[model samples]
Target: MTVPASTAPPQDEVSPDALQAATTPQSPARRRGADTRALTQVLFGQLKELEPGTPEHSRVRAALIEANLPLVRYAAARFRSRNEPMEDVVQVGTIGLI
Candidate 1:
């Protein structure tokens, strides 16, 4: 799915500090969890406003999947001792996530 051009902020308006801060390591797990929840809520709200089968909707759905990938990885980790490939576990977890 392609992200619509209008969804992106103009490149010239993005400051170096903002980019740096976004890439920097977050605080503790509690703070990160709260941030994730807030982001999810906002994305879902945006998704709700868009029409289904449109690029904007697909972009939001893709964003939701990308945002929660860590959760899939964490769940997949629990099966590490089952003699299965980690990739396989992660793939299955991702499918469940979708």
Candidate 2:
């Protein structure tokens, strides 16, 4: 999510007045979903370029899993009333995600 310094707008070039906008704030869940989608797209693109079983491919695959962990947790929360351990639920959900 880090923007490179070279791509940053210069401080003097930014207008404070232009920064004001009337917009509804997005909920954290919505924002996170959007971010996850974008990250997954980028990572998948990278994954396609990498040869399977290479270190880079493995790293990107791991990143994809990590980035989507929130989704697994969210799904796992639905089963909370079932009396199963939360960690176990998440683990099973993660396995499905993988």
Candidate 3:
């Protein structure tokens, strides 16, 4: 299942501070959209260096998971209904992401 890319902000909307925040290796919990794009790039770059099955590889993979979690949530929200709990949907989406 493909998650839509609507979580990211348009390139023109990114501010200087947001760009700076994205470049640095830090938690991007507060900044959405543009920041998530930047973090994704950084994480992908790091992923290239680490071999699979290693601890460092797993760490970077986890970072990728966290970075794209909002996407999972956004996708899961679409399926939420009286019968389906949001938490279960999110968990399943997260698993799909992994």
Candidate 4:
């Protein structure tokens, strides 16, 4: 799922083929449902150290947020009947994760 940054041509090169792919809306990858729970528990278990503000700590926090995004989306979906947009709701929920 990792797209290589180096694979992108420089801005000055502007090829039509590349532009099409770049503008296309890619479907999100399927989330790891069952494994997410165990993975989240393991990551939380490793947070025993006192350095909560460190880069490693940030990465773990980011991983936890990414791992549980589906839950946030689900929670956001409950508010779909309201006037707010789903995307905005999901975004707010995502920030709440941190």
Candidate 5:
């Protein structure tokens, strides 16, 4: 999962929210058994050349983008089961990525 940058403590200070976050119990089953390989291929296929990349290689960016999507699907699926509408779920997930 992506950590929120704003929550990270600076070199000499800490925050209550960050401390509470550390103690939070995360879900073990990330999703109802997602097909990570398939998801990665799908995400990678959907991406364009986005940029020349830091060193002109596409694989690095593709991997980075792919790595985050299964979690997106998982969060989306959970919202879906919790009564969120399908279109809304996808929109929320997209917003999460942004």
Candidate 6:
């Protein structure tokens, strides 16, 4: 099922650093909205470009990851905690390793 654009966060709202992940090529049509695929594209594109060694790149990457954290947290919140720790919740949300 397609997610509504309004409920999804805007791609532009995602930080530039997070958008650098290496990714599969995408056409303009794929980049048009805020669905999970679009977000995946944005994240992978950033990860691909992220310069792992430099401090600047490190900071940006951290920031982007940080920014995306809220969304992930929100997703994890959907399932019952079931005595799961908060760290586990975050780890589960971090499945977007795209």
On lDDT, the candidate that comes out on top is: 2
The deviation in Å at residue 38 for candidate 2 is: 0.9
Q: Give the lDDT of residue 38 in candidate 6.
A: 56
Model 4 Cα displacement at 97 (Å)? 0.6
The best candidate by TM-score is 2
- Output candidate 5 Cα RMSD: 14.3
Give each model a TM-score: 0.65, 0.71, 0.61, 0.60, 0.34, 0.40
Q: RMSD per prediction, one decimal?
A: 14.9, 10.5, 16.4, 13.7, 14.3, 17.8
Of the candidates numbered 3 and 6, which has the greater lDDT value?
A: 3
List lDDT for all candidates, in order: 0.91, 0.92, 0.87, 0.84, 0.64, 0.65
Residue pairs that clash (backbone atoms under 3 angstroms), model 1: none
**Residue-pair clashes per candidate, as listed?**
0, 0, 0, 0, 0, 13
| Model 4 agreement with the true structure over 1-98: per-residue lDDT tens digits | 87688996655878999899889866544335657888998889876663889988888888888889988988999999999999999999988997
Candidate 1 stretches greater than 4 Å from native: 1-27
Task: Please give, for residues 1-98, the per-residue lDDT of candidate 5 as tens digits.
Answer: 88798987767577989988878865665442355556656656545444555453466555655577667776787775566687788777867764
Residues 1-98, candidate 2: write the lDDT tens digits: 99999999877655555554325577898988999999999999999999999999999999999999999999999999998999999999999999
lDDT of 2 at 63: 99
- Candidate 6 residues lying further than 4 Å off, grouped into runs, are 1-50, 81-87, 94-98
Candidate ranking under lDDT, highest first, comes to: 2, 1, 3, 4, 6, 5
